[model samples]
Target: MNHFPPLRLLVTFEALSRHGSMRDAAARLNVTQPAVSQAIKALEDYIGVRLIDRSVRPSRMTEEGELLARAVREGLGRISATLEDIRAMQTDADRQITVACTLGVATYWLMPRLSGFYDRHPEITVNVQAPASDLPVLSPGVDIALRYGTGGWREGINGKLFDEIVCPVGSPDLVARLMEDGVDLDTAPLIHVRNPHNQHWAGWEDYLAVKGITRPRSSGQSFNNYVQAMQAVIDGRGLMLGWRSITERAVLEGTLTEWPNGTHDLGTAYYVSTGVDPSKDALLFTQWLREEAT
Candidate 1:
């Protein structure tokens, strides 16, 4: 290994930090779990200190690991952002389609279905940017914007993707505990996400009112990012509001479970917006998205 260990190790560590567990990192990186383990071990040996604390299930990082992970995340993010800008500078005739969306939608909804689209249309190059919230605007460089809202963007043709449903969800353990203890929703250690960018989203108060629950949210913590908030829910820290498109896959995977009979559909749906005159690739991508939605 050279002066900084292989770039692969750093990349793997970033994925691990983002995804939380080895199996998840492997799924995100499209590699085997053993391979992820080996990459971390190699990087730890090169750095001459332990990066991962394997004592706990799902293996969290140590302080040293957090330092390196933070640096690597920021560094890689800058590099990726620069590359996107460079890609945007390319000519339109090059036929690369750039789609703008939020990180949660990219991670949960689009990513899982992307491989299928790529497999069918290998010639099309898709560049996805998740720099903002659910209602991503169509900038000069963006061809398509997948936004979450009631749908009436003045600039483009807006088509609905899926209706939004919000509800309380927590780890499978928490679900079992609540069921066993016969606990009510108002008293749980609710996980709150305070995303200032997404004011359209409903909170516990709104959700509780719709359900006719008079009790206030007694105990909880707040996170600025949805990712960290969801992580807390998965770790059994508390119940957080879950969206159908965003949280259904994790629920299906058995990591999180919906609170027993606790769900309400918000009147918003995700929509794909594009200019009046769309490109070939952009049209194809939107069509594929619609097909996926159906």
Candidate 2:
């Protein structure tokens, strides 16, 4: 029998190491802070080494901890991939494909035009998984992913979709209300997108600074996902930093309007990568997506 700690304990420790905070790790694992601590202690007892250095303010992993953490990440990743391969064998061939992307892209962008693909090929079922991060790992079951970056993901075959452009956008009513009320744009209530991987998505600070408009970072609602933030904007709650890939359709449809400031051409672009061996349906969907972008 394997004498290592329980898999759950190792999983919890991995989360804690990844987040660098017990509370944040617990949040990711859906457990309490004390539970995280207990799990770490249990793992330490099993491994006979202190995984965490409690002396640090943010509680970092010790050298021994780093070694174990690396091993766990790699081991779990391999195990997960093997399980996915087994599941795929049980599943019907070429009937199902999964696409992974951020919630905003899935909601405002891809979901709007998904029916077109289905109309052409009704046999394939596209499973869209919109996780919190724009750059999520393309695990076993996921056939493809749409990520925003400089196109160097070795996980699969990747290609650039298009260069990204971002700007301030809001509902027509909200802009009109702010104008009528003579509210200062800088101090006005605005939407903010907060994420652990903040670099992937541009925020108000980057937008305002590029436009030479100084503004306070603290304003209106802050949502962890753009789906909620954009919804808040549609409800006229506040204006949000918007990107072409996610907000262009909404603006063109008159559901949203761009503010006076010009757009920012983020040198980086969005990219799409596919699994090692994608199904014919997956390839068709990818080709359709590429043609649509042009």
Q: Give the per-residue lDDT of model 1 (tens digit) for 155-200.
A: 9888898888887899998889988998887677788877777787
How many steric clashes between backbone atoms does each model show?
0, 0
For each candidate, give its TM-score against the true structure: 0.67, 0.65
Which regions in candidate 1 have their CA more than 4 angstroms from the true location? 1-93, 215-218
- lDDT by residue for model 2 (17-89), tens: 7888888998998889999999899889898889889897867889999999899999989999999998876
Error at 248, model 1, angstroms: 0.8
The 0-to-1 C-alpha lDDT of every candidate, in the order given, reads 0.86, 0.84
RMSD of 2: 16.8
